[model samples]
Target: MLIFGAAVARDRAWDVAVELAERVGAPVWAAPASERAPFPEDHPLYVGGLPFATGPLAERLRGHDLAVIIGAPVFRYYPYVAGPYLPDGLRLLHITDDPAEAARAPVGDSLVSSAGVAMQMLVGALRRDRREPEALTPQEHRMAPHPPTDATAADAVMSARQLFATLRSACEADTVLVEESPSNLADLHAEWPITEPDSFYTFASGGLGWNLPASVGIALAESDSGRRRAVVAIIGDGSFQYSVQSIWTAAQHGLDILFVVPRNGEYAILKAFAELEDTPGVPGLDIPGIDFVALATAYGCHGVRASTPAEVAAEVAAARDRSGPTLLEVAINAAVPSLL
Candidate 1:
């Protein structure tokens, strides 16, 4: 199967690939890097990135009888090749969140839902034919703490581990979490697993500001269906600012939602990338001293700010007890890497 798309799609597609592989008992092969399928090098099922030409990969696919493409366009780029990438007479199915992509890809079968939902549906359909895997052993479940020696004085306040641990404690079985912390994704994936069908997590698409809006959407969906699930959005300060205006919509609709902002003074991810490049700090990356609490208050929602892990836990607990919309900002150390 060729799974490709935005990073959000990549994250979701991984889950989909896991389910599909288990169902069909087929080894999934991915193409090389293009705009669509940017396969994570660290992942186990990754074949390799697609090259400018597909002749080599197409030859490899000649043995497979069917190809299922998910969350990517039919063909990202031809690179001057005027031939079908699929072997002659091979069956193809495509699935995507975007109907436009499904229409453009011309799939034999198409499903319209987020990648996570699609995976859930596929897993449900395959459940009769498959047995559940064993749960993680207690030893495997043990996670290490963020090493204190690795932290600088300025980095001691709120580490990613602290944030994720606090959230994990507070999360209910039915909670839906929409995450847009690009730099914190690895840490989160390492710490959290989807143990229940109702526990949903989604990240940004190609768009920068999806967390807040997606939380609102999920909240609305839950409320309209009379479900008691909480919709929580975890956003980084840099990404939150992109769609800060969405808070008003949540407040207006009276959606029961919790918004948590991890505030560092700069675009910490980009700053780290700059350090890797051995370049000096880029100007305008630092956004000093913005009042997120007051911004939430202005939008007619409850707001609170916490500078320590304890305070963060307290504020989140208080927000969860409320019936309406609320925003809580946790001030974090910006200098440390967001993921281990």
Candidate 2:
């Protein structure tokens, strides 16, 4: 099985990955840190992102005897929890550019090289030996277009699930997402499966407010290339406030970026963490009276407010088609989500 990671996605090595997978009949897996899926999730031999914890990951990889890691670390974990690193009896072979990652991994034999080049050589050797890998039966894609009814509007306001489904339906196929709203990622993963390379991005550093600035930089680069791909930065109000100044830079450059701010009036992710840790809800988590629309207009970018589904779709189209930057402040339910 192949584990595709951020380096692979950033390096644009999906073509070689597909060739290697096809030749070896190997199942491909994506990591959560991966910007977008290198291998199409619809492929029969393609697996979803790995589980969050060590125990859960071992269970998920139980059936696979061999794990070939490509362009990613052996594992990137969080939560500071301790457990078994890998399943017993499973051998790992890594091919990556970073020797540090290979050396630090608990268990793995690594080949230091360009992942694309290594895969090409491996495919050539396999062909020379006339080795025929197992062919998997293709299966129909299982993702549903919309989430459950209860998952949509919470407290009669647009929910996280609703926002993602609406964006998925409204945006162009090549549109890419730069995500920072951690509380809503579960909804994105559920409704919006990564079908294309470089279509989705998120910071795995667990740091807040970084993606907003990064999104602006990505917009500038994409605009410079003259690609028609829409760049949407779907961020939380808390995250947006941290780097609100970036909007000025985006507007100054006339970047064609669509900033979608889900206004829940508080740090919902932190609330979830408080519940998980059995600690009291911290003060100063609630944010109010921040006029994002006014801020956007002052910065010379267009802004809109959308509370209904139809209104949101219209705003999405406007943001995507506009020549300059635009911000859509969507009022959403202030419901606390489960800790990731």
Candidate 3:
């Protein structure tokens, strides 16, 4: 199996990674928490992102005898899950541009080189192997979409799955997605298929307060380059507060960026961590009474609220035709996900 990281796309080697995967007849898994789409998610060889912990990642790659990891750390983990990094007898070769990334890995043989150069060299040196590409039959390889929820109730809040499915259907194929909603990561990844290069971006280190401002910059660049692809940012309510002032910049400059805030009235990601760590009854996890639409209006951007799928579709369509940035806050169910 082959694995790719953010640097593979960052260094403009997406095509090379795809070519190399095709040459080796291996399926590709984007490294855990990868910020960019190194390989097209629509490709047959693409198996989606890996798990974020040691044991789960190893178990996910169980049948693979040798794994070639490119342009990423050997592994990036969270919650301090204790287990072996790789399964017994499974060999790994880590290739990356940063020496620090190569040095700190707990397992695997490391090589430091430019991601594009190393992959190009490998493409020339390695012949296409005869091994039949293995089938990815289990749920770990790709997350199946959740069944669509009924959005008919007068005051019912949509689940994250429903919201993502609605957005996926409404969004354009070439739309650039800037995502920072950690709690909704699984649903969003399963629903939204990123088919084009440079169309999806997130913070590799999972930092807060970066994506909102970064979306502004991306929209500005899009306008200047004459490629006016719609830029939509999916930010959690907790993360939206970290750099809420940045929306003012987007408004002042008239950048056409759409900020979709999933208002669940809590820090869902932190709650998930607390559960994983067995530290329950944590105080101050629920955050209530924050008016995101009002805050957007205060920042001089158009603001609205959507509670159902139809409303969400209408609001997104209207935002696209608007001249400036808009913020659409959607009410979503507050189900905390198991992050393993």
Candidate 4:
């Protein structure tokens, strides 16, 4: 089976894979990239990472009777070469957090729900069936070494670990986290442990500039229920540029939302890729100094700039006290290694 999504969805997908494999007594294939660590690599049922081309992946699944995909995108990219992974009449089941993703993927059956809830339901059903145990083999336990940490403290104002811990501590149980900084999510996921279901975490459809707007949607949902759950959006500076207008909506609605901007003044992910390819720097990647706080103020939302951990903590606390929208601009060192 195949599953894909953001970090939070990836974790839910893994849970679903584990339960399904055990119930059907079949091996499970996980394709989370090396960047997403702490996954159950020790499991023997793991088939290995998914290949880049569909031909190879389909060839590997030649005799499989069913294909289950979660979280992962089906139309991520195209390479032209194609073959049916499932034989004629084989069943295909897909689960995804995004309804759009579920609707877009080629599938016979699909479930549209948060990945966490869908996984819990699937596992609960399997447990009711009292399936036999199908554990991983010893050989499959061997996995690639962990990715090296190449980020320097000077590159980022605060490490992803530090930022998550601070936020986790400052927020209440009902808080919702909307994440669009895809490049930093690996580190964020590894550092944060999600134990509650209400703490909704969302990622874009492998697309940029959805973070701020998505957070607004989540906040509006919470407001409709008359719940006091705080909505927090951790967005990259580059991503925030895409839907900056959302701030005005949040202010107009008086939504209790906080926008955390991890500013590095450049598309750090693209720069890293370019460096790896030994290519000259690309144009329009660098974002010169922009006062995000001022932009937020222009939208009638409270704003603050944080350059240190203490300042971040203080600003977060202040935003939490406010009853309306606020923006916290964090000047992170752009030199940090890409968690991808």
Best by lDDT: 3
lDDT per residue (tens digit) for residues 106-213 in model 4: 645777766657666767776456445455442221211112234545644776556666776777766777776655654554444433444645532346776688
What shift in Å separates residue 5 of candidate 1 from its native position after superposition? 7.9
Local distance difference test, per candidate? 0.61, 0.75, 0.84, 0.63
**lDDT tens digits, residues 21-98, model 1?**
556555444333232223333343444333323454455457657776656555544233344566776777766677
Cα lDDT tens digits, model 3, 171-259, are 88889999988877777777787778899888876688899899999999999999999999999998998899999999999999999
lDDT of model 1, residue 42: 33
Ranking by TM-score: 3, 2, 4, 1
Write down the lDDT that model 1 would get: 0.61
Q: Which is the better candidate, 1 or 4, if ranked by lDDT? A: 4
Task: Report residue 169 deviation for candidate 4 (angstroms).
Answer: 2.4
TM-score of each: 0.62, 0.87, 0.93, 0.67
Residue pairs with colliding backbones in model 1 are 4-37, 5-36, 31-50, 32-49, 32-50, 33-49, 33-50
Model 1's TM-score against the true structure: 0.62
Ranking by lDDT: 3, 2, 4, 1
In model 4, how large is the Cα lDDT of residue 325? 95
Error of 1 at 139 (Å): 16
For model 4, the run of ten residues with the poorest summed lDDT: 139-148
Off by over 4 Å in 4: 1-67, 70-75, 78-149, 201-203, 273-278, 336-340
